[model samples]
Target: MSGSETIGSYLNRLAAGRPTPGGGATGALQAAQGAALLGMAARFTTGEGYEDQADRMERIASRSEEIIRRALKVSDDDQEAFAAVAESYKLPGETADEEADRSEAIQRALLGAVEPPRELTRIAAEVIEMCAEIVGVVNPNVLSDVAAAAESARAAASTAIVTLEINIRAVDDEGTRDELRRDVERGEVAVATAATVTRRVRDDLAR
Candidate 1:
């Protein structure tokens, strides 16, 4: 995206008949949005009356920025990874040697496709933890924003798990598959924990 494309332009590209900006890229973008919300919530909590929590909020803001920046990078990486996958599928598959080469390329590309989403999963978990930390401690005025952050982060983690599962199914190496499975499980657990905390925030907001 070159970091300069408008939101509408990006969405148009995503909606077009193209495979580059697929599910993995979208998952990273969602995580980025969640991180942004978390940062905003922390910003609201850091001034004047909230002096006691200033340090924590400042840390949260910093970490949240890093997470979102990483997510943008992940999005770009995922697009490139999937583009490679699409190209690999187009490799010739006529003779025995040709078929074998095509298969090898596809396998390698599939493995490459798993990486960006896995990194986003880790980042989303960190964002979820930050949301949990600031839920009650953030400015009461932006409690809804904090709650939204938790929900958005949970959604991002959940999406990463789905993307991981799809890619891991095609993985040939048992060791690599096991590692991917562990990552997916970790992401699932992180989302579940975020959901628990978000429910508390929701209940409190309701009261």
Candidate 2:
């Protein structure tokens, strides 16, 4: 999606029979939405009662903006990366040399394809952390939005990790797979934290 692409336009493209803007891109967008909601909550967490937290809220707001930008860029990058993966599979491989070259290219492309979603999971984890920080402090008016943000981050992390897992499984390097496994572990932690945040919000609402 371009910087100016409408949501409807993007949805149309996503629904088409193409593969570039798939789960990885969707995961990035989910992270971006989560960060955006966090930013809004941070901005609202100000005024007389929130004076002691003004500096902290400001920092969260700033960092959330950065995360949102990075997540959107990741969305675009995932499209390009997945496109490269598809192209790598198309490489001519009839002969021995060509087959060897194609296999190497596909492995390289798969590794490259994993990075965007991996980064997205990191981003989602950070978003979840931010939500954890502000869940108790954000304005009551936007309290539920904090949970919404956490849930969005959870979805982002889950989707991105799935994408990462599939790509990493196809990758031949054991060391790289080990590293990605750690990233998946972190994504799981983020998902758990997101659930905690949602529960906290629900508890508060009950009270």
Best by lDDT: 2
Where in model 1 is the C-alpha error above 4 Å?
none
lDDT of 1 by residue, 46-72 (tens): 768999998899998998888888999
Error of 2 at 45 (Å): 0.7
> Cα RMSD for candidate 2?
0.8
Worst 10 residues of 1 by lDDT: 146-155
- For candidate 1, give the lDDT of residue 141: 84
Candidate 2 Cα deviation (angstroms), residue 160: 1.2
The C-alpha lDDT values of all candidates are 0.86, 0.93
Q: Which consecutive 10 residues in model 2 have the weakest lDDT in total?
A: 160-169
Across residues 48-154, which tens digit of lDDT does each residue of candidate 2 receive? 99999999999999999999889999999999999998999999999999999999999999888889988998999999999999899889999999999999999
